[model samples]
Target chain A: MITIDGVTKIRGRTRILHEVSFTARPGRVTGFLGPNGAGKTSTLRVLLGLDRPQAGTALIDGRRYADHDRPLTVAGALLDGSGAHRSRSARAHLRWVAASNGLPRARVEEVLDLVGLSADAGKRAGRFSLGMGRRLGLATALLGDPPVLILDEPVNGLDPAGIRWMRTFLRDSAATGRTVLLSSHLMGELAETADDVVIIDRGRVVAAGTLAEVVGEHATLEDAFLDRTASEGVSW
Target chain B: MTGPRRVAGAVHAEAIKLITLPSLALTVALTWALTALLGLTGRPGGVLVYTQVGFLVLGVLAATHEYQGGGQIRASLLAVPRRPLLAVAKIVALAGIAAPFALVAAVLAGRPGATGGLLLDLVLAAGVGMLVKHSVGATGLVLTAYEIVSPLVRTHLPEVARLPSSAWTAAVLLVAIAIFARREA
Candidate 1:
């Protein structure tokens, strides 16, 4: 379970996220939906301890990410894929990340296989296509086989086959009674994959519930999201 | 093994990454080839001197790529959130990669590699890599000083001029470690 309590963030003296809060429970794919600059990344950063929130806290399984002894084993995360070193091979990349969390060497290969990149595992990430890079990122996230997974924009540049593969993987991951939280702007994508939806606009929760509940009274999930966001206007 | 071994793994990862890239390999090869050419042409020990600073740019880029990319740093921070631990891992990794190169330089200099000074240089390189979050700018400046300023300083202030690259490397590594640990990942 991931608990985000009253999280507030300010970037460069301007408020980005104001008192934003939500809960992502296990056995469900909770989609963190927001427009660009709506504090989606900011909130993710706070949760991963990349940025300190001026107020509130983000907890994974009731403990902060940093507090966990082997964080990779408790919660696995992949925020962005472009951060990989262009020079390093995918195998080397996963090896070091695994070693950091004290995971065994075999697990690296295991996740590589899980992500269907075992053959290209020796290739450098710099040379990977966007779709392949996403696969590598997913492999890293699954390296520890952690009960919780957090992925932001996991399907951004994927092809149809890649999207289908990702949707299945995420669903199966959650079905195992693991907690999964994915963020995306595509409502239809979320509608198909996410069990629950936490919609945010202008850094605050506009609405959050099961996919069916938030999509009510609107023509579609997209219409519902647009209506809710449009009604709120824009704020710092 | 536990203390330095873990750090060694991180450093090994960085060093291996440094060698694996075709660009980095080209850079190092060019440095060595140019250094050898310079040595064979007229200048004595040019290869040794040039190669010493040549690879520093690659070292800096190793970490700079992480800082520039939003993901690697985040993944690294997530796995090892303790800033000092991560910093140490970098130091260990950089040093592990650097040790053999430094020894090769010493061999080219026709001197048995001395552990004390080379260890110091590795430490300094780590520090510089940390402080700059990658060393392109700093490496350029250092190389510039080595070529132009070091000679002038040596002629005028002989005492200051006597400082070895290895010593400066150690100092830089220490400063880099301090700066790296203090910052948020």
Candidate 2:
């Protein structure tokens, strides 16, 4: 389970997250939906302990992310880019990350196969295309086979087939009881894959609940998001 | 994992990064090559002057490499969230990689005072890199510092400290540790 409560963040005098409170339960895919610059990445960063919040807390299971002894085995996260140095081969990148978490070296190959990047194991990360980079990032996330998965715009760079594969992968992950929380601006994508949804606009949670609850009488998730965000020229 | 074990893992991971970074091998080779060139010319004096440039760069890149290639710092911090510990592990790993070479460079320089700041240059470079996150900028700043400090720190007895006062050192050390731990990834 993941809990973000009253989480507020400020960067350079701009309030990026305002009392953002939500919960993503195990065995459910929570789609954190927001438009560009709407604090999705900021929230995820705080949850992962990559950034500090001035107020409130973000918890994985029951403790802060930094408090975990083996955080990778507790929660796996994929943020922007490949998360590997450009000069490093994918295999080398995975190996070091595994070593940091005290995970076995074999998990590197296992995750490479899981993400279908085994063929490109020897390729340098800088040489990867957008789709390939996403795959590499996903491979890094799965290195520990953690129970919680947090991703930001995971399907942003994927091709159609890749997108389909990711959709299936995230669904299967949640089906098997992992807590999956992904942030994206793709409403149509979220509508199809998300069991629950949280919509943020200008650093505030405009709405959140089950996918059905969020969509409500609106024609689709897109409509609901547009109705909430595309108005009054308010973007902070 | 206990604190020490976790630190060990971080250090291990950091060493692997330094080993596999193509630039690391290149930097070390260039430093050693220049050391050899200076040795052959018999201009390798008590303190290595020209060759200190390579060691300075080695340190800066070692510290700032995580901020490159779409920022590996995110992945690194994600793996080891104890930010201060990560920073310390990074330096420890850099020391491990550079120590043997430092000894080699000292022996090759064939002078008593040449070994004074071989690995210390890398640590200094790391501290500068932390102050300036950009590698190019950090490298330039570190080199510039080397230029200014080289004349003063010519031998083993003379030391040029970035923060000479203990109080100032403590203040800067606290600031650096806070930045490493609390800065946004």
Candidate 3:
């Protein structure tokens, strides 16, 4: 479970997030929706303890991410796929991250296989297509098999097949009782996989609830998203 | 994760990443090639001089690549969480990787008792690399600093005090990399 309460983040003189609050529950996939620059990444950073909130708290499983003894085992996250060295092979890239958290070495191969990148594991990451890179990033996030998964644009560069694999993987992970918070601009995809939705516009929660509750009579979540976005007139 | 252990893991991960980059291999190869060329030309002043340039480049590339990625800074912060601890891990790892190469160069260059100074140069290079975050620029600054304190200019200084400028170069490199890597952009 993740709880963010009254979080405020100020970048220089500009306020990025103002008293934003939300909760992600176990056994459900929560889609974190926001326009670009709406503090989505900043909020994720705070939740991961990468950035300190000026006036509130961001907690995971009742404690800050930094406070966890085995952080990877509590929450696995992939904020961006470009975190690894481009010249390093995919397998080598995953090896170091897994080893850093004392995760078993075999976990590297397992995740590579899980992401269906085992065939290209030895190839340099720089040579990978954006889709392949996303898979490698997912493999890294899944290395520790934590109870919570936080992914930002996990399907940014995936092909249709890869997207299907990701959706299935996320649903299965949530079905196993893991809390999943996935952020994306792809509303239809989110509507298909997300059990809950948290919508943010200009850094504040505009709406949040079960998918059925949030969608209402919009016919589709994309239409609902467009409605909320247009109604708010918030340009990210 | 808590205390020194997590820091150690962070450092280890950083070190592996440091060494595993093809750039590191290329830099090492370039250093040996340059050293051998300088040797043939009878310019084997000190091992510190031979290795400083390459390691300095390593330092610059290491930090800049992360900055360019737009995510390493955040990932590193998430992994370690403590500013000073993370800074220490980065500096230590950079030094650990550079020292041996500097040492080998010093031995090959036949600079008697210059291995220690060469290690110091590595530290300085790492610091500078952190600051400039550009291998070419960092290497230039290190070279400039080296020339300023070279034996030719500081002849009146004590033989030990006149230790190759590369020694101080490493120290400066450490301080630079630490400040640059840790500071909020």
Among these predictions, the greatest TM-score belongs to: 2
Candidate 3 wrongly placed segments (more than 4 Å): A232-236, B1-4, B44-48, B68-73, B148-185
User: Model 1 residue A94 lDDT?
Assistant: 85
Q: All candidates' TM-scores?
A: 0.86, 0.93, 0.88
Greater lDDT among 1 and 2 belongs to 2
Model 1, A101-181: lDDT tens per residue? 667889989998888899998887889999888888888888888999999988999999999999998999899999999
Superposed by TM-score, candidate 3 places the C-alpha of residue A51 at a distance from the truth, in angstroms, of 3.1
Ranking by TM-score: 2, 3, 1
Per-residue lDDT of model 3, residues A1-236, tens digit only: 99989999887888889999999999999998877887888888888877667899999999999778667778888877646667788887887777667678899999999988999999988888888878877787788889999999787878899889889999999999999999888888898899999888777877899999889998988888778877846555
Interface RMSD, every prediction, one decimal place = 3.4, 0.9, 2.5
Q: Candidate 3 chain A: worst 10 consecutive residues by lDDT?
A: A227-236
Give the alpha carbon lDDT tens digit for every residue of A107-222 in model 2.
99999999988999999999999999999999999988999999999998899999999999999999999999999999889998999999998899999999999889999999
> lDDT per prediction?
0.75, 0.86, 0.76
- In candidate 2, the residue pairs with backbone N, CA or C atoms under 3 Å apart (3 or more residues apart, or in different chains) clash, namely none
The superposed Cα distance between candidate 2 and the true structure at residue B69, in angstroms, equals 2.2
**Which parts of model 1 are misplaced by more than 4 Å?**
A232-236, B1-47, B68-71, B113-126, B148-171, B182-185
By lDDT, the better pick of 1 and 3 is 3
Model 2's alpha-carbon lDDT is 0.86
